[model samples]
Target: MELGKIERLLDRYDEGETSIAEEKLLREYFLSEDVPEHLRSYQLMFRFSASQAEEKLENKPKVVSKRNWYSWTSIAAILIVALGIFFYNDSSRMLNDNGLGTISDEELALQKTKETLHMVAQIMNEGKSDLVYLKEFNNTKNKIIQID
Candidate 1:
């Protein structure tokens, strides 16, 4: 191979314009034992590339069958549907058994609401009475701070 041609290819390679065939020619030239001293520095790189290309993978690719995947997916779907139906029927049965499916009269519901509110108000008033102790404690702490 002509040194001029190799120099031209090198320039093109550096410019990212060299074709695969040109690159192969350059690699072969650099890998040869008679590589010129000026081009000897590039020999190591080409030798490394050649060695890498010749390397064989130790582990073969694993082949997976998708047939079992479809079956498993279908089984999972069936189980989901079965569980959903079971839960729905159970919930409906519980609601019906507990008489929650029936509607109460508006007047009765209003009476119950008023009773619940009265109880809540009574509880809140009791809680407010307890807060009186908290107010006394706060006053005592403030007086102690002033003394310090």
Candidate 2:
């Protein structure tokens, strides 16, 4: 092909106006060893493009599928649930043989109740004393400001 035609094709190719056939022609021209010195850079580029187009992926891609993770997680979740159920059942099955059984004694129960009530009454009296101080402060504030 004429250098002028090749140059015009290149110009159209740059402007994105050339058809695929015109681009193939440009590639063929550039691939030839007789490419003009000025167009040698384009030759190198077209040669690289050709070589890359011929290249292929030799190995299949290593796809990390979520299936493995999901399977493992499900297995782990099942194992955890099984272990929890086993422990719960086993603990319940074990007898309360370690001095932890309940014994009923009316007198002892009555004494415990009385002591609990006495402590509750003491706590209530302490809280009530704090309430008396708050009431005195409110009364003094009412005397000074008369907030109705």
Candidate 3:
């Protein structure tokens, strides 16, 4: 409120050292209708500073340059090509005109066991369906004989 205090605050403000609360106080004091005409110029300064502070920054985050874009694109392309080449080479190595390498004895035995179990399951399912059809056929045959 005192002229000396206001002058000190103004000095702090000019040095960009004023806290937000201090700045608000300054703005309110300078904007009041009772403000002395001698201090009128300072009112404009605070108003401008406040408006400038509130302004939304233009080009926030800035545009990515073409060179940076090209660099990242080329890096991604190279990685993709490397991945493709690695997978292709690995697959090619795993295969040949004769097919993949011969299985180990243990692996062969396991495969044989899997195939046997699959065939057995298939046979059991087929027998179950056949039994169901036979039962139905016998019932119909008996009814026909009875009708006769």
Per-candidate Cα lDDT values, in order, are: 0.87, 0.88, 0.86
What does candidate 3's lDDT look like per residue over 28-136, in tens digits? 8886666667788998887787789899977779789999999999999999999998877556666676645555689887998899899999999988987988899
lDDT of each residue in 83-134, candidate 1, tens digit only: 9988775555555555754447888888888998999999999999999999
lDDT of 2 by residue, 90-148 (tens): 65556666646443788987888899899999999999889988999998998989755
Clashes of each: 0, 0, 0
Best by lDDT: 2
Candidate 2, after superposition: displacement of residue 7 in Å? 1.4
lDDT of 3 at 4: 78
TM-score, one value per model:
0.52, 0.46, 0.35
Q: What RMSD, rounded to one decimal, does every model reach?
A: 12.0, 13.1, 19.2
RMSD of 1: 12.0
lDDT of 1: 0.87
Task: Give lDDT: candidate 3, residue 143.
Answer: 100
In what order do the candidates fall by lDDT, top score first?
2, 1, 3
